[model samples]
Target: MADQVLMELGDRLRVARKVEGSSGAVLASRAGVTQPTVSRVENGQRVSSVEAVERLIAALPLPPEEAERLTSMAREAYALASEGKRVDSGVSLVPDAARKLFTAASRVRGFQSATIPAPLRSSEYAAAAGADSDSGADWAKNLDDAGKSFEFVVTESALRTWPGSGESMPAQLEHLLTLAQRPNVSLTVIPWGVGLPVMPPHGFTVCDESGVLVETFTATMTLTGSEHVAAYRDAFEALAAVAVTGDEFRRVVEDVAADLTRFIQ
Candidate 1:
């Protein structure tokens, strides 16, 4: 298989600039490069030389420590690009990789049209879905830190109708309700059968300004290019816009829980 893994230099640069409130034009002006060059470099599309990247870093005006870290990241990114491809099993490694994304990000966003987000899934439901032992509160622990935010959206079909876990569905719905009440958690359910002009082919999780993790049946892909991250971020925001929440969403949960209770009884 061709190598799909990538390093996150562009994403790092873009995020650092946002944190510093520097515009592309401003960074370009400071770095002695055109805005297009700054844009391209931050998206990891093109850079003429390592010296140019150094100039871009200097433009960020990062403190000495941060600048050095970014320089090292740029080198790793260049190395990865040169190699072009790496293949890994990714099953065992995904959990730790996900943990890293969680710990590093202050904000997280997720979209799942077919199932619940892992962070909000009940232990039993997670197990039913063949998720790792890391579920329920353990998943929440991934977000247990200062200044963290989680926004997740799932289709109504996924939220209320988990198959193969008739007994666990109620508890999972209740768990969603519980997470919905938390200050830092925003759980939205898009109504069943809502027409979306563009339905996402697969679920994805975005970590703050840098990372996007896409889950497949066999492996999880950690995406790093700034352009790709930006695209995922835009998709997340678009989905979040139309999702149902607040009391309306609560009522939907209640309805589902009642239905589940009747079925189990």
Candidate 2:
């Protein structure tokens, strides 16, 4: 994972440099680092200190906005490396390039139009939702890890809907009730009575600090471009605004679980 993050960090650094219209040697000279250090840093063969990270950002001739984005990404990479956790493995690799963004994320915003969000899903619920092959197991494990790593926001529709086994619905509602007890996790339900339109045609998962993963049945789309992310951020905030919280949210879960029992029977 470290190796993957290192390589990914290098790739982002290199991309930022190119986007700034600069050369590696030029950046090294501006940042007061040796050319090889610059090369290694960009290749993930070496980690850069916070000071060095700042210098590299300074070396880029990008506008203040773009430079700040690069700096934030660099700091995230350094922090992940410090923890010895690879940002490029497990569910991180979903949708390919989104892996890099998730590595640097401080928060996550997820919406499930058809099923419960993975992080809030129970082991049984997750299995029932889809196939139980190695990939599914990896996804469940990844979802569990992500739950520990970020602040999760879920819609009410996702919380109540059951797509798999009959018992899975009640189990899923119970599982979410348990997860919501965590300080880091915040679960909200978008009530059926809410006047809001359906979440944009696409299902999107946003990194609180960076990137957006827009998924489809066939392919997962990773969005890192600032403008695109900003749009999704707006959409997330809007969805969050109408979601049910606290006691009301929990009540909805229990009610849904009870309602689902009849189907199973």
Candidate 3:
């Protein structure tokens, strides 16, 4: 969704530049931004800052309505990354928009302290947890996209707590193990005995270092400001530091799954 907005804005800006008979270099000088930045904006690639978009708008010889339209589009493009807008809907409730973020990003890092991360959730698990079962389909498909990488750090308790039926949980755990084996996927688990470096209040996903989506009970907050995103990145790293990965992670999950299997029997 954000990508679409940026692309449209880029197209409009390109047309406006042509109408003004301005070269990319001329526009860059007029906007006081680098030529590459101007090129990126015109190409619909994410810009460094919202200020760059504003400056480009200011430099362009656009009519009042067109200028406002482009400005609006710019805001929407950066709304999740710059303004840190809060959407009332749960992240899972808007699958299409959320899917776009994953599709556009080259890397996605997520930390879940309570529940299974959405991308790693099985359909049955998601349905049992009251999340839209189909919401995670795109993520599952994206696992095959070798160009993108996904990393998830989850607490051991989250894996132990089965939201679905006893029979369903084994499948979910199996799904996690399968996903963990993917070349581009990394699943890490913080064991029960591991001491945490910091306590995170909730789960958050950072997309391509561009924005962080902090998930809460009622709404999801988009923190795109560089500082806020950096903080979340730090938090994720803190959790990942104490988490087990590779064979150790598999053992932890397998241990939980084994216990569950015994209990189910």
TM-score of 3: 0.62
Q: Per-prediction count of colliding residue pairs? A: 1, 4, 1
Tens digit of lDDT per residue, candidate 1, span 110-168? 99988888788777887777786443456677655546888898888776667584777
Please give the range of 10 consecutive residues that has the lowest summed lDDT in model 2: 131-140
Q: Give the alpha carbon lDDT tens digit for every residue of 1-265 in model 2.
A: 5557557767877997888788876887788865555666676654336567668768776689877876776677666656854444223335446544554565777766666655556677767777333223443344445444444455556655666455777766777788777666677777777765334776677886467886656555676544356556656666777788789888887888777767786
Residue 154 local lDDT, model 3 = 95
Give per-residue lDDT, candidate 3, residue 245. 93
Ordered list by TM-score, greatest first: 1, 3, 2
TM-score of every model versus the real structure? 0.62, 0.57, 0.62
**What lDDT score belongs to each candidate, Candidate 1 first?**
0.73, 0.65, 0.78
What overall lDDT, based on C-alpha atoms, would model 3 receive against the true structure?
Answer: 0.78
lDDT of 3 by residue, 1-265 (tens): 8878888889889999999999987998889876656767887777657889989998998998888888888987787554554443222445354556656789999998778888888887777777753345545777788988999999999888866465668888999999988899999999998887667788888888777777666555566655456556766776787899989999998999989967666
RMSD of each: 11.1, 14.0, 12.8
Clashing pairs in 2: 10-42, 107-208, 156-189, 156-190
How does candidate 1 fare on TM-score? 0.62
